[model samples]
Target: MSNAYTSPIPIKRTNLGHALASEWTKIKSVRSTVWTLSIFLILVIGIGLLAVANTQSDDYQDVPFTVPAFFGLMLGQICLITLGVLVTSSEYGTGMIRTTFTASPQRHRVLAAKALIFFAIAFVASAGSILLVGLMASGAHSGPEAGDIAWGGTVVKGGLYVSLLGVLALAVGSMLRHSAGAITTMLGVVLVPAILPGFLGIWESTQKLGEKMGDYNAINSLAAIFQIDGPDSSTGSSQLVLLIVITAAAVVGAFALLEKRDV
Candidate 1:
């Protein structure tokens, strides 16, 4: 008999699929994921129904049936943002990232996996909730007067927009490596531009700058996607393009930092 021995177990090279599976497991197994998503569902669905119930048939004349969903999403997105930060920052807090990095030596792959998985979850949840609300609203208020209710457009664009925001939060989390700090940074990113414009408007010299910022802030971007009137003439496509550019830049920065930084 030969002295060499081989084990019966088989091994395969790891790839993005393996990383994705691992991330999926981690995300699903966490309590924070469950809680945050639960709250998001409640806020989106509950508030949407309430808004619809309070409205008259005339309310749908100008706005799409899905407009009510926007109100709930405005608050629900905070939950997604919080969840996004926790996805990465939680691991760092508990020192679990070391093991994750060891299991997947390619840091970029791990981050990519996280981003893909998170985006899928966020998009599905957001779109589903919006669709449910839209259907309810349409059923309750659809009539000849409700002209051109673009609920379908709202569902697709609204979902994509919210999902990108979550991914951006993930990038911020990865770069910051702290939960509270990353969440705060994202909140500021969302709110500061919107609020700053109001303050800037008080001064004549900065009024134009304020108008420019207000036109492009997160609130206006979201409102435009929902087919609501905003301060500026920015179309949904323009706002989405701007968001995509910002998110891509943040993701690139996260990848670069992950490569250079020690675990």
Candidate 2:
């Protein structure tokens, strides 16, 4: 009734939590999340059980006893990366990103929230499957010192690897703004290094560099997480450093583009 009438409801300033909640809802609501994660879990658990059914005496000589679970996880990683790319790229594909930006108006915050949520979900699923596989492997066989193998450390590292890979995929998606392109790029990044090095082996002078590339690649990082030992083996530190550095650079580029480009 008065000229200076107050509002009935209070307005609260938004923060990162709001963004996170939004991303969580979006991720959960998507069919891609369900399909991709379902496939990942099935492959990891099913392959792990198969490995347990065929546990060999020499299997754990150089690798952790739970190493069989990694075979399925290795294949399942592609799906995780696809989901990561789709998280941002699909929005761009269908123009949902405009709505997201309209609601938030803070692009970087949105990206951060998406990355955090995806990382958490991917890590939990990967780690849970790996742990279940490890437990199944340990108990499935009654071999001597079955429970004494280095299971915890390698399993944890594998989870971290998958989580980091998902983050990298998300950053790539934000930069490319195309799901297919970003997914292809992620696949190349993960696989080419392992194969390219072999081609480079023909040149004697380049052989060392090629070997280094293979050892430092994303595929090798999965092996490193398994802590497999041999001349071809690598530790997680080098692979993690390489992948994280590239992902960080991509994320910075994505933020820069967000500011310069119109929705």
TM-score for each model: 0.95, 0.93
Q: What is candidate 1's CA lDDT for residue 160? A: 91
How does model 1 fare in lDDT?
0.91
Candidate 2 has its poorest 10 consecutive residues by lDDT at 141-150
The residue-by-residue lDDT of candidate 1 on 11-71, one tens digit each, is: 8999999999999999999999999999999999999999999998887777888889999
Candidate 2 regions exceeding 4 Å error are 145-147, 230-234
Per-residue lDDT of 1-263 in model 2, one digit per residue for the tens? Answer: 66987899998888999999999999999899999999999998899889888876556555666687788988999989999999999999999999999999988899999998999999999989999888787666637634345678767778878777888899889889999899999999889988899999999999999989988876677888777663245557667767778777877888888788887
Q: Quote model 1's TM-score.
A: 0.95
In candidate 1, stretches whose alpha carbon ends up further than 4 angstroms from where it belongs are 1-5, 230-234
In order, the Cα lDDT scores of the candidates are 0.91, 0.84
Please give the lDDT score at residue 109 for candidate 2.
Answer: 93
Model 1 worst lDDT run, 10 consecutive residues: 227-236
